[model samples]
Target chain A: MQPVYEVHKLSKYYGRIRALDHLDLALAPGKLVGLLGPNGSGKTTLIKIGAGLLTPDQGSVLIGGMAPGPATKAIVSYLPDRMALPTEMTTKDVVSMYSDFFADFDRVKAQEMLRDLHLSDSQRIGSMSKGTQEKVQLCLVMSRAAKLYLLDEPLGGVDPAAREYILSTILRNYSEDSAVLFSTHLISDIEKVLDEVAILRQGKLLLHDSVDHLRQEKGMSVDEFFKEVFRC
Target chain B: MNWNITAGRPVYVQLIEQLELAIVTGEYPPGSRIPAVRELAAEAGVNPNTMQRALQDLESRGLLQSQRTSGRIVSANQDTLHTLRVQRAEVYVADFLRQMHKLGYTQEETLELLQKATFPTVSNTKEES
Candidate 1:
């Protein structure tokens, strides 16, 4: 099957620093892929380029047969590491805003999720805790039935309980036709959900394959293999 | 369910292997109810759907059985676990030997590392602890 998102020879630079260096990535439909990397490994830079939030200095990124334009944006649901919602907006307001912007946004699913979590719609974003705000952000992103979901650091910097909630939300909301690419340094936590993984180091692609293939061939955990491969 | 996956294998398979190991190790014994998918998922810091896939796979393999209201339970027999463990151990040994060869460890040197590793003698007094 053709890849939903095909990134070829993609390279990005931050002045003199190369954030993404000739990175090639492909995503199949319904795949939940983990993007693993150390700090400054260009995971975010790749996601930003995929989200159209940043432009590549060289190379190309295609989402759903087009560049990262409105056409691709319509089908891609992107969650940045930080919450981008307005602090002044209420939870309901955020839901309403998403409903208005993305026609594919499932209002009922959003409401049902809120009900499941017992979160009050009346709660204002500014008053909620960071973890709670993350829940709200997750609800809005997952509620959309996008073709591709780019979750940058979905499990990063969150409490253990909150991490569980976020990962579950992604799994439950994503459909079989949709592809989810999540990037984080917290490998052990999110490693279970990832059907495939792409390990990045120093802005280079070190490995990419089904987790089973790696384990069966090497007879080691991804974490141990990572430590050994990237050992100084 | 709250397993922090330490395996190098695919997540779903690693998940199944871990659960199988738990059952074999009597962590979740035969006929005993295991954590609900959501509960285990929440505990292990993983996605419920991912955990669900592992549970379903194990259930089909007869390593686990899932009931409607009671959640999942360990399968009665553990022959599957024993078979898998033996296969994995062989792979681990092969890789270990390969690495030892790559690291230029002679047969005697490798045996020494193994003995020092397996049976810490008086010479193993590294006082670090």
Candidate 2:
């Protein structure tokens, strides 16, 4: 089977500040991979390249055998690190907007998730708490039946309880034919939900292996290994 | 079923052990259908792939049987279940012995300690009588 996402010797630069340097990675379908690194470790850069927000200076990235383009965009659902939704729009309005824009969007599922979270259609995005906004965005992103999901810091800034809810929502909504790549600094909180882990540092890929193999080989959890590998 | 997953060990290994415990203790019950992989993965807050690996491991061990239409069911064989129970208990016993050895106790000393720990209630009852 073809990999859901692939990158080969990909390189990117920000006016001489290298963000991604000769990085190669691949994600197979039916896996939840944790893209882990510290701040300014090129995690976001790699995700952005995969999402088509930025073009690599060298090499190539393919999503489901096609480069990031309109075709690939249709199958990639990206949730940026910060809020990207229109604040003036109500929760109901956002659902309608997504449904109108993406043919694969499931409005009913989005509404059901919103209702379960006790969020009303009348609630405006600007008025909701930061955590609530994140939840709403997650609902919108996950409501799409996309083949690949690139979530940047989906658990960041949320309280522990909300984090648990978000993690379970992602797990419950995930499709077996699709793959999810979510980047986070909080490794311990999200390690359980990941089948594989890719650790990056200083614009380079450090390690990418199955979580079980890592634990069995090192006799330590992913979080512990991350701390040891990226320790100052 | 509260899954106490710690960071010191592999999550899938823990998953396998807890799932085996659930089946052997009758929490899932013999011959009962288990929840779908996605549902159990959500409940455990782990990825479906990781959960799938654990389930596959159990299926290979003959503790679980997968049906095409009905999903996975715990082993219905009483003999298999009984054997699993014994195997699980033996693991605990081996772990205890290893810990005692770590604490500098020889096999004889460990057996003595086990006897002492097991007979206090009997001796107290005899005294009261």
- Model 1: which docking level applies? incorrect
* After superposition, candidate 2 runs with Cα above 4 Å error: B93-129
Instruction: Please write out the lDDT profile of model 2 over residues A23-141, one tens digit for every residue.
Output: 99999998899999889989999989889999999998999999889999889999999998999999989999999989889998999888877787999999999888988998899
DockQ of the candidate models in sequence? 0.18, 0.65
TM-score of each candidate structure, all chains considered together: 0.69, 0.88
Pairs of colliding residues, candidate 1? A211-B10, A212-B10, A220-B8, A221-B7, A221-B8, A222-B8, B2-B44
Model 1, A1-232: lDDT tens digits are 6687889989988888989899888998877888887889999998888889998888988888788888888999998899888999899999999999898999999998887666789899999887778778877888899999999887766778767677777766656688889998777666666778899987888889976677678788667777788777
How many Å off is the CA of B108 in candidate 1? 38
Candidate 1: fnat, from 0 to 1?
Answer: 0.31
Q: Can you tell me the DockQ of model 2?
A: 0.65
Q: Quick one: best lDDT, which candidate?
A: 2
For residue B91, model 1's alpha carbon misses the true position, in angstroms, by 20
**TM (B chain), model 1:** 0.71
lDDT of 1 at A104: 90
Model 1 per-residue lDDT tens digits across residues B25-51:
678878899977656765555545667
